[model samples]
Target: MTESKLRDIRWIFILLAAYFALQVGVRLATSHSLDLDEAEQVFRSQWLAAGYGPQPPFYNWLQYTVFQITGVSLAALSVVKNLLLFISYLLYGLTARLVLRDKALVAISTLGLLTIPQMVFEMQRDLTHTVAVFFSASIFFYGFIRSLKQPSLASYLIAGIGIGFGLLAKYNFAILPAAALIAALADARLRPRIFERRLALTAAVALIITLPHLFWLKDNLDFATARTLEKMTASDNASYPMQVAMGVSSLALAVISFAGLTVAVFATVFGKKLRSALAAQSEWTRLLERMMLVFLTGILLLIVFGGAAGIKDRWLVPMLFIVPLYFCLKIEAAGEETDKAFRRFMPIVTVIMIGVPAALYGSVATARFSGHYERLNRPYAGMLEILRKQAEPAAILAGDSLLAGNLRQDIPDIHVLSMDYPGFKPDISGRRPLLLVWLIPHKGENEALPPAMAQWLRANLGVSAPEALVIGVPYVYGRGDDSYRFGYAWVHPPS
Candidate 1:
């Protein structure tokens, strides 16, 4: 690599580091409350298990490790997430460097990721599992490309490790390696690498990494897959034909939502050069194009036979993350001058990098004026303060995961349980004070404990009826009228 190109790559890494650091600061300043995904992490991180609900255990496992080091705080949560995101971007840059000849193309492809709203906005806002999948996907792609190009024991091992972790990241991530293998086999030159003895190393490493989880999954299939299966068949009540139609429409919309912005930004900046570059093709581009085709075909087959009616855009992230690189490859193939294009791209990328953090802050800071309350606007700290003063409970049981997670975050020492996840039951059976918590949605609403929470209490604690203690606390930034009402029952230990 040339000195200037190496310098450019170094700067890109520096910028990525700075950008993610900024995200951590923004999240800390945003609010004391946790978002849904953030809360789920907090709640689940209480235990390090082989499996956790519908999602895989990799991200949760990482979060748990971070908590051990940093303690369960907002900073720990934010840092873990942003760190994964930074690694993902870095891995993508390395992958781009392997495939594309020009440094400018590598930079362009990497920065182009910021244009995808799902990656930039949605992932940052509230996505834990999907973010892990994205990071794993990047590792897989980089390893896959490097192994194919260099054909080494180390590279193959890297590919194997990626495959193992990718599976642990999300169940949907299985398609990426499958699609990649199919794509590689189709290429005459790359086909030999698939049959090489080094491939066994990759397979063995992957199996070793994933075997423990496989055993856990075998025993608790329903616990692991129930929620994901329900989501996939959300439209099952519709007629067969209608189900197929909606599935197809949803697939289309997901693709558009995932790729539309990147396409638009490239087209707008690169103009006719990008349009003309579409006709250009190469070995690498063909491999990518074929991989995408196989991936989409796999999804289509699922829609037709697997009864997957609700397709989310975020689910498509790991599969189509190569779009930006593919575009840059075409631009390079067409011999288009990219220096000018890169100059134009940097400004847009800069604005987005700055704007997203600002928006995250603004969403919480201005919630009082807008009368719009996001999860961040919840006064979890104040509510927890009141609950702590009433009785120092040994355990806290909440109506839902959201409440359970926030409660756990504020009081890390207490055992927090949620009705939403019954699979994880901590022992609160002893003679110790227990706090039962639930939300009251609107003013003048009944302050009775939610039915689920009540049932859980009866089944676990043998308490048939528990009186509710209603407390009203203002939102983080709210008018006097805007108060969040919470009902809690402090069950003292029997003498």
Candidate 2:
């Protein structure tokens, strides 16, 4: 590499480091409790299962390893998140360089990724589908690009590993390989490489890595996949028209997220001549444009025609990071100077990137002082402490998955079991004590346990319910006045 090119790459590293440093500070300072999904991820990480619960097992395995090394803490989770994000940014730069010879354009395109909300905010918060898939997809493309350019055994092997791990990360990764195959078939240059021996090697490696999970899925009756599918479609009660409408709206949400950002960035870079800039493009740029469009169309058709009920905002995260990169290519193709956009817009991106995490911390801090109740302000530690004293049980069980999951990671000696999991049939036959806990909206101190919770305790515990113990747990951010009360009932195992 030329000295100039090396310098550009160094700049990319520096900026990424700055972003990561800010993320660490925000994660440490922010007092919000883990979101339900976040807590569940940590809980699932305890065991090295082939598969379990709702998500794939690879994510949990990674977290479990981190837990072993760093011990279980929010900072440890955030460290893993930032590390994966750094990999993502590195891969993005590599992919951009493969197509665009200009190192400046490559750096601009990769850094521009932070401008996407999903890329920055979502990544810092947890190791969710987006973060996992983000790294998986990025790595896959990096190897895919190298394999296409070189077509050597090593390149194909690397590509195969990327595919394997990506799928292991999230089921959604299955879409990416299919899209690439279609792209190759459609493009004459890419089509000839399809029959190469290395491609078969790639497939074999992916299959070998994922085979264990495949068997696990079969043994578990594909319960997680089934549950995921059920959630994607509408309920039987909804009319067909309504389902279609909801699906379409969800589809629009994903599109608008990119559309707004894309238009604004192009307008900022090209001013009124945006149409002209987009109109002119090189052959490679055009090929990639087609491939991305095909990838997106495939996802949309499946969601719309496949009878999906509604689209959650998070479901679109994996592909959304590509939006800024696509725009960067367009801006380059438009014959505009990238240096100008880099100099002008980068500061704005940096501010927003840094400001986002800061804003989150500020919001949480404000809530703590304002005496407002919020999930981010929950007193997870305090709740766990109170429960520890109330019952010495073999396991903890709860109707709410979130509550059980949060406590489970903190108290690893006891299995924190969620009653709501589809396949979790607990063997409560042994004569050991069990503690059942649940949360209610923070009514005043004198409030009684909700009737449903009381009824549940009575039915399951096999005794007249004793007066519930109300333990006040202070919120992470709240003042002395900000606290939540958890009610508990102890159940002994059957004789």
Candidate 3:
């Protein structure tokens, strides 16, 4: 690498480190309450299993490991996510370096990820599994490209590790490797790697890593697939033809939503040059193009034949993350000067880098004035303080994962259980005092125990009826009048 190129790469690393550090700070400062994904992690991290719900166990395993060291603090959650994301960008930059000759294009390819709102905004906000899959996909791309270019045993092993972790991260990541395999097989030059004897090593490594989960999935098939199947065929109640149409349309919209911003940003910065680059195709560019084609085709097939009806843009991260790299590759092929384009792109990306974190902070900080109480704005700490003042309970039962998770974070030592996760049955039966906690929707009127919690209490604790304590705490940054209510009841152990 030239001195200038090396300097640019150093700066890229610095930018990633600084950005992720800021994200960690924002998360710590945001709120004590967990979002949906964060809550799920907190709940699941209580126990380590081969599989957790419909999603695979890789990300959970990482979170559990982090929690082991950090003891389930907000720092553990934020640092794990931001660190993984930082490494993902680094891997992506390395992959781009392999494919493109220009250093400027290399920097552009990596930094261009910022233009994707899902990565910059949503992933940082509250994403767990999706972020893991993105990291694994980046690993696979870098390793796969390196092996093909340099043909090293270590690179092949790295690719295998990526495949193993990708599957363990999310089932949806399976398509990426499948597409790459198809794309490689179609190319005469790249076909040898598929038939090469070393490929066995790759297969073996992936199988060994995934074998335990396969067994767990086999025993708990419904647990692994039921919710996903339900979401995929959510529109199955409609006519078959209508289902297909909706599936197709949903997939189309998902693609547009996922890739639209990156395309728009590139168009704005590079303008006619980007348009011209579209026609410039090289062997490596064709490889990526074909890989994308096969990936989309797989999704389309699932929609038409498999009755997939729901699709989300975030799910496309693994496959579509290559957009920036692909564009930069084509730009290089077209012999275009990116100095001017880079100048324009950097300012827009800089604004986004600053704006997203600020927005996350503002959303919570200004919730009192706006009367928009996001999950973070809820006074979980305040509620916990009041609950502790009344009685120190041996165990806490929450109606949902969100409540359970926040409670667990606040009181890490106490046994916190969520009604949502039935499989996790910690023995709260012999508790000195068991606390039943549920959210009270409205402010003024008295509310009874939620039906789910009521049934759980009766069946599990043999408490037919328990007095409900309605506790209202002011929002984190709210007027004294603006209070979030919680319904709690204490169940004393039977004599």
Candidate 4:
């Protein structure tokens, strides 16, 4: 903590203030409803209780806390996300300082990395990525730094436990242990200190943290094989147009973010002379860079496959965890003349990256604010209103999975008796002869039930089915009467 080091931290704090000021303002102005994922967490958080339907409880629990502390509206809770996001940036900046040890360089790199939209958007939205990224990076960097002072049982415990919190946010964080192993091996100073005995202690801590989620995952999706299936199924999103966009947008983000961490990654690979000459004189410093690289490699794999397959830009956002480290590279990756050019334009690009996403987000918010539009959740808002008004407290109905989330929000007392798998099931009661509902389609457009279920439902109910079914993709009511999107909502009148 030299005077110079202290001054550098102050400057980073200043930059953080400026970045989030714009981000939070944008969040406030744009009024988008909870996203499908957000709604999933909220519904799970509110309805399902301790362990929400097939998902880990930690993220939902955090959302519940925000709901309790800040109330149900997502706006205030979004502020908490802002805080987590801030922590992530600080962690990245701190990593930058540790490597480059240059205040100006660290500031520029951090600014540049924040431009990756998913990172900023996750920070603004009330979801677990913020908490996961924040705790995971904070813990790893903290323990990694501490190991240098005097390797201790407690330091490893802290690092392992921090990753535990990260796992609670998302299962992919389990990759952290591998990063630690690689970093320790690569780091000359930290290597000898990290022998079998110390590594075992870290392993035990990580294992202890993992048990509960393991239990939760066991029933829903086999954590190991299920992730691959989930990844494969996600390929449905890779439309011709989507593949192109995913490739371009994801790569652009990765390159920009890597630019931020370039110095640290490069230096870790080759910065032996430079780091030893500077501060702390701990061999562990290089370990930190390689550790981050291992982390980066895992994320890069996820993105490459995820993007080609059409996974959401935002789903893999946690991997943006490496951006701040990448920022350092942008500064240090180049030699003198090239470095000067990067210095001149890097900050501007950083600002543009952050600003443009904020603007797009703001536009989304504005659109929601101006009109009663329906996305995944809101489109069902009107339908849920209709169902609530029409159905009995015990009405049994099947539903689209997307709409089930929203209907659950409105019809707390209503039960989803049954539904097609992989779609929304509104009925929680899980009993027989459920009063099925359907949207009457125009003639020749009735959706056929899948063969097996259609046979089963018909056999039990003892009738040829009517010309209709209650479920559709919760179509919305637009400005004028247009049957294109909204199907006429009708229940079967008594036979």
Candidate 5:
């Protein structure tokens, strides 16, 4: 590598460090509570199993490993996520260096990733799609670029590992390989590369890595896939036409939101000279750009057809990791003005990098005084204590996964069972009591136990009138006057 290239790589790391520091500072100042997604991974990591519930095992396995290494706490969880995100940023930069040789354009493409709200803002708080899958997707894309450049056994093997592990991280990873196949078929130059002996080895490696999880998935009755499908096909009161319209709009919004970030970066870095840059690229360079287009288009179509309700915008976050590079390659400046534009834009980029975290920190810090707490701001400590005192039960019966996950994380040695998904029927032998719990936000009025929890109590414990207790927990930063309410019911062992 040229000394200049080395210096650019160094700058990327420095910027990454600064970004991570900002994230950590915001987390500490706000005493950020773990979101359901974040808490769920930490909770799942507590147990070392090939499979858990209806989700892929790799994320949980990774979490469990981290917890074991660092010990479990909210801080430890944040650290793990930060490290994963940092690795993703590095992988993306390295891949950009490989594909786009222009140093200024590469730097802008690498740092510009944070401009996407989903990449930095949403990811800092989310554990699954944003953290785990983001890292895996980054690896997959890096390997993909290398393999496409040179279809050697080593490159193909790296790509295969990326595919296998990415799938293990999240099922959506299947989209990457599917996109590759479609892109190759469309590009005559790349089509023959897919039939190579080493590419076959790529498939074998992925299959081998994924084999154990496949067995576990089968043995568990493929709960993960079934649950995912159920979620997609969940009943909706809206007419079919309405559902289609809503799905189409949501899909469009997600794509546009992503594209807007790239467009902004391109405009700032290349300005009016962008068209010339595209016209000047070699055919090979342009082919790589089209591959990204093919990949995203394929993934977008699949998601739209799935018809899932309230499809999380975060699901599309991975598709954008390499998109900044994709756009830069297409619209990079042909003249030295590219350097001048980037220099002028540095201040603006810095402002964006700092302003986003400051805004998030401000919103969270003010929520306590406003008496309106988002889910992450709600206090969990007092509720955990109340559940312990009232039930002193052997296990925690959580009404939802988020509540259950936090309970498990905060209170050690307690087996948290979800009433919403009662897959665990602990043996009646020894007859241990269960602490049934749920969160009822501070909405001015006293909330009753959820109907589902009430039904579960009656059906399982034959105690329809379980004791109702409301415990008040102050918000993380709340004055004594501001707090959250928890409704709990203690159920005795079955008679």
Candidate 6:
């Protein structure tokens, strides 16, 4: 690399470093709020023996790689988190360079990805969304850029590889080809010649990449739908209006997310002069303009509830390049000068990029520490305390539904059992004394065990009906009717 070019890369690295420093410093300084998904990721990853469960294998693959590199410590995971964050930024940088030819505009777009709050946080968590987003951006960037240059076999082959990786990352990634094809078709000047032998090769490459995942799915036929069904039915969704509004905001937010593709899409599609102007531009710029339209349409499809949860906003993160590319196109059209519109939107983007997420997560972290909401998990230390106190070899114990999992984790050899199931009782004829842990204590349920929980406890725990059990209150909480109560601990027999 030339000296000046080396300096430019260094500048990009510094900005990315600053973004990551903020992410980890804030995550550590405030309290650690364990997202259930992240904890479950830790729980699952540790026990992972590869191909043992449902869901695609890539996330486990990525997390396992991180663990191997970092040596299984919390600090190591933190390092891994930052490492993934850096990789996401690097992919965005490459995507920007490919989509926006202007060096300055490309740098700014790179910054835009670096500071996106949703983008930043997604890296810290164990969600598969970031990797999906990375390949999604990659496929869009490489496919159209190649279409412009020479349409060489190698170029199409690379684009095909990107598409395949994207499919592995997310099911939604298939939208890219559909949107790109539609946009290309509309451009009469380009469509006929564009879909030549090379495009067919691209498709073939993607199919080749998708084959392994297809076979894996074939093996876990029931598990795929089973897992999808679980997430779909996980909870009762809210009112229709709220779901609709959420979908709208999530779709619309894509505009502000990185480069505000909405502005570019409107300028190109509805802007009175974009098509005429595009015909006169250099070939590479024309290719980029075509991509902006294609990418923007993909955003619209997402707003249409294209496999969205219809709730989580960051689900749209995979399409980060849309607006940035759009903004860059508009800037290029305006002779690389900062226009009035650019000036107006830039600060808003910056603030929303950094400020919004910090405020939202900051409030959530504060609320958690302040006892504003009920947490489903019991303290690991508290569980350990109870185990040490009860200290008996082969102790027969039962835990609330949640406790059974960690109880086994924290005290493996104990005859730990569940009160959630029917006739699950102590191995009385065995040597361990009986004890119970409520990994999750619900006040109302504990105060008066539900008939199901009560019967299960009585029949399986070797306890008498009703009041014969002495319960120890563990965690405190507020009920639905605005009441405070404790989820108490229980001893099967009131000895």
Off by over 4 Å in 2: 1-7, 235-238, 387-394, 422-433, 442-467, 492-495
**In model 1, what is the error at residue 463, expressed in angstroms?**
2.4
Give Cα-based local distance difference scores for all models. 0.89, 0.71, 0.88, 0.52, 0.71, 0.52
Quote each prediction's TM-score: 0.97, 0.88, 0.97, 0.65, 0.87, 0.63
User: In terms of lDDT, which candidate is strongest?
Assistant: 1
State residue 449's C-alpha deviation in candidate 2, in Å: 7.2
lDDT of 4 at 433: 28
- TM-score computed on alpha carbons, candidate 6: 0.63
Question: Looking at model 1, how many pairs of residues clash?
Answer: 0
- Model 2 pairs whose backbones collide: 368-477, 368-478
- What pairs collide in candidate 6? 259-323, 259-324, 261-323, 425-460, 472-489, 473-488
Q: In model 2, how many backbone clashes occur?
A: 2
After aligning candidate 3 to the native by TM-score, how far in Å is the CA of 271 from where it should be? 0.7
The TM-score obtained by model 3 is 0.97
TM-score of 5: 0.87
What are the per-residue Cα lDDT tens digits for candidate 3 across 343-454?
9988988998899999989988897688878888777778988889988989999888988988888888878899888888887666468888888867565588778888
lDDT of 2 at 208: 99
Per residue, candidate 1 scores C-alpha lDDT tens digits across 63-136 of 99999988999999899999999999998998898888888889989989998999999988999999999998
Go through the candidates in order and give the clash count of each: 0, 2, 0, 26, 0, 6
Candidate 2, residues 1-495, lDDT tens digits: the string is 356755667778777877787787787777536776578776666557788855777667788898888777777777777888888888788778766766667877787777666566656655466688888888777777777775788778877887888888888777777766777677787777777777999999999989998888787755667777788885566777777777778778866774566567657755755566677786555656666777678666766678886666556655555666666667667776656666767777767776888776776788745776557678877787766775667877665767766786577665666656534445554566767676755475444545655565566555555455566777776687656777776666556
lDDT of 1: 0.89
Give per-residue CA lDDT, model 5, range 76-107, as digits (tens): 76676787888888888878887776777788
For candidate 4, write residues 33-92 as lDDT tens digits. Answer: 455555454455444343344335666666677766655554544565666667666766
